[model samples]
Target chain A: MITIALPKGALLSDSIELFKRLGLDFTAFLDSKNRQLQITDPTNTAKGLLVRATDVPVYVEYGQAQLGIVGYDLLLEKTPDVAHLADLNFGGCRMSVAVPKTSPYQTPTELPPNGKVASKFVNCAKTYFQQLDLPVEIIPLYGSVELGPITGMSEAIVDLVSTGRTLKENGLVEVDTLFQSTARLIAHPLSYRLNLDNLNDLGEQIKNSVSKS
Target chain B: MITIALPKGALLSDSIELFKRLGLDFTAFLDSKNRQLQITDPTNTAKGLLVRATDVPVYVEYGQAQLGIVGYDLLLEKTPDVAHLADLNFGGCRMSVAVPKTSPYQTPTELPPNGKVASKFVNCAKTYFQQLDLPVEIIPLYGSVELGPITGMSEAIVDLVSTGRTLKENGLVEVDTLFQSTARLIAHPLSYRLNLDNLNDLGEQIKNSVSKS
Candidate 1:
């Protein structure tokens, strides 16, 4: 049996739709009343686990799910040992360094030495700043990265920005973008290599689905 | 003016109720239709910021909030430099190490050396294991830690166990508990030390509220 891990928020519907096109039905997740995190498709050939976007890689890395649909940003932040199967290409977003609009410093480098930068993606933020040779403290905030700047907890924040609505509403402006993110189909390395449960075939169908879409 | 950081989920209502008893009201948060993250008490003497439970310390530590209500577990995990003031005596839970029912290990020490232990509270788990002189890899998971054992991702999971319903339903059992957690009233170090915003007076009122309740 093949199991797939699907992210719960912005990428869920598109992920379900893509899987539906591949002949696996797990749309029960879209129902507002449905609270089940794990569900098996009607055919029983596959099952899906709805989890946080950040957990997709963990599930796939441990072979709990032979495959997972996750954002590329998480792939960067976590760098879990999973096969980068293919890009399914929906749920586009970007990770960027943002600061309060009123701040005098414009770019990451302009921020003061040893200043604090907050993010949920700590590793991603750390790497970005390190590459720039900026020695700043990366405070890991699990929620509301905007609060980092709004509350003066940090000089700036590195966060996922989509539509720029949340950032603008919070009076934060993007100073530098690290990368663009899109939905990605990832597989467990051993499962893909061993062709366990015909994952290679399902993986190929998913790749085809992306191309067709 | 004083700002208080109140947690957003299960503890929110209780935190507000406690504050109400102390003569400060931020009850707008309890309204089902309310969408605001930040609200001011009608009396205009204090403001409240509704944020993730883990973020309360960040707000208070940065002095954005003179006070905060948060779980004791977070204090152990984040170890943010904040003054531990009072325990409000509500929002009770426990930090525990849980394992799958079928797992061979019956206790933390029984688990194989260097086994991967998954937790959102990686620090707590690591500390507990280290104190036991057990060297294990602590994998940080952001959601539904029960999946750690169910998926064979880790030997066991250290997570918050409330009623233990989630763990029981997932076929896991708690092998040990790190500590019981209750919502604690914490203050910014400088704010509490300097009695800024008459924090000492407000602090005594909060302490009285808890005792009176």
Candidate 2:
């Protein structure tokens, strides 16, 4: 049976809906009381493994899941060895460089050369700064990137800004946008090539579903 | 006023209680409705920054906070340069190497050489295997590591076993333990030395409270 790794957060409901259109019912994962990480569709056609968004690529890369749905931002940061199948286009957000609204700096270039920047996406932050020929220290923070500026630990933060509410409420403003992000469909390279468990047909169907949606 | 960094999860309440013993009330952070990440104690004597467990050390190291409470496992993994003040002793757990109950492996050495061991504590895993002279690939997973072996992503997982309930529910069994972990009090090195804002005195008071408890 083809197993699909589904991301657990913002993209979850839509991912389940997409699969539901394909006649696979894995929505049991959406139940608040459901603690099971791995569940099989009622039709016994495919299985779903609910995992963290960042881990979707890892499972697909290891061939544990023939296909997975993840964020485009994660694809860029992790660069996992998986086939880029399609862009599902939901869960839209942008990777942005933000600074305290009260700060005089208005853009990434205006920031001090050696200033500290905090982000969960350290790799993306490093690449963005490097491409600008800017030298800044990237402090990796696992949570509360918005607090970076408030606490004075960092001059700026590179984070995903979906509604600008989080930034606005935290007294921060977007200094520069790195890139837009949305949900992406990925498949294991070998699994895709071999058409394991009729994965090609399912992939094509999902792509059609995405195009229509 | 001295600023203290408190971790957000499991250790939060205990940490708040610890500070209350120091004559500071940061219980507002315990309210479910409170979205504030940074809060000043009722008396304005000190401020608290609620951050992820791993980020606690970063805040203290950068002196954004003169003191912080975090897990010892994080201290071992990140090796942040901060003064290890005292062990608060709450939130006890241990890092252990666990494998599927059905697996033949009985210990870390019994696992295949060059096999994958998934964990969030990659450095600690690396160091443990290196000391044991076992070569294993440490796959850094950010969440739900208990699913590692179940998904066939790794031969075993090195994770913090709190109640062993998670491991049991996942059909995993602990094979070898790395070390015990508990909440630890940490302070900025320079802040502690110079008694910045009487941080030395506060540290002593906390130590006394911990000892009495």
Candidate 3:
């Protein structure tokens, strides 16, 4: 049976709706109160595994699940080995560089040499700065990176900006954008090769729904 | 007045207790329904700012709060610049390397050259592997990294192991201990330098509580 890993939070509802259009009844497994990790569909053609959104790719890449739905922010940061089947078009946002409103660093290049930048996405921030040949000390933060500049710990941050409300409330402004992010359909390379017929059908149905939307 | 950043979840109760011993009344802010960001103490000697455990350091480091209480696991993973003032000896855990029980790799050195290691603490994993000169791809996962090796996505994972129950349930075995972790008292360098007198007193009281415990 084909197995799909679905992110357990915000994306779960939309993912379930998408699968329903594919004629897959995965609603029982998608129920928020269901603590059961793995649930089989009544039709027995497929199964669903609920997991953290950031973990969807890991599950797919390892072939634990034939397919997965995850955010682009995670994909950009982790760069998992799974094949990008299609963009699901939900959970959209932008990964951007933000700085305190009072800071003089308006552009990426204007950032000082060897200055500190705090972000939960340390590797992502490092790669961004490396492209500019700028030496930076990446201070890894799990959340609330806006406080980096406010508390004088770092000069800027590279994080997901959903509505600009978080930045605005924290007295920060976007300095540069790295990428536009949206949820995408991903599959294990081996799974795609092993279950080509079934996976292809599933992919087509997802694409059809996305196009319709 | 001095300000303190306390974790909003499990640690909140303990933090309130500690502050009460310090002659500060912060119990009312512990209500989970309280939407107020900052709550003032009755005597106004200090104010409490409730935030995520992962965000505690960000608040303290940015000088938004002079001191913070956070788990050592988060501190090791984040490696923020804030001073490690005192070890609170709570929220104890160990960051360790783990792999699927079926894998033959027994030690860190046994990992195949250029193998993949997954972790939410990407920086921590990178530094650990680099110190041993191991050439492995560090896959950054947000959570549930234990599932990586189980599903064959990665060879191993570096994550916090509290009771080892989670690992055992997933058919994973501990391979190596990385670091011992506990909750800690952290201070912004500038805050410590400027408010040495008051900060030191508060630090002393907290230290006394830790020693007694």
B1-213 per-residue lDDT for model 1 (tens digits): 999999999899999998887778999999999978888898888999989998899889888899999999999988999999999999999999999999999999998996999899988998899999999999788888887877677999999999999999999999999999999999999989999989999999999888888
Most accurate candidate by lDDT: 2
DockQ of 1: 0.67
Q: Could you tell me how far off, in angstroms, the CA of residue A70 lies in candidate 1 after the best superposition?
A: 0.9
Q: Write the per-residue lDDT of candidate 2 for residues B1-213, one digit (tens) a residue.
A: 999999989999999998998789999999999988889988889999989988999999999999999999999999999999999989999999999999988788999996999999999999999999988899888899988899888999999989999999899999999999999999999989999898888999999999999
lDDT of 2 by residue, A1-213 (tens): 999999989999999999999899998998999989999999999999999999899999989999999999999999999999999989999999999988978888999998999999999999999999999999999998988888889999999989999899899999899999999999999989999899999999999998998
Q: For this target, which candidate reaches the highest DockQ against the unseen true structure?
A: 2
lDDT of 3 by residue, A29-90 (tens): 65558756677777777888878887788778767788899998888788899989899888
Question: How high is the lDDT of residue A50 in model 2?
Answer: 94
By lDDT rank, best first, the candidates go 2, 1, 3
- Model 1 segments beyond 4 Å from truth? B101-104, B114-116
For all predicted structures, in order, the TM-scores are: 0.92, 0.97, 0.76
TM-score between candidate 3 and the true structure: 0.76
What interface-residue Cα RMSD does candidate 3 give after superposition?
3.7
Q: Give every prediction's interface RMSD.
A: 1.9, 0.9, 3.7
Q: In model 2, state the lDDT of residue B148.
A: 87
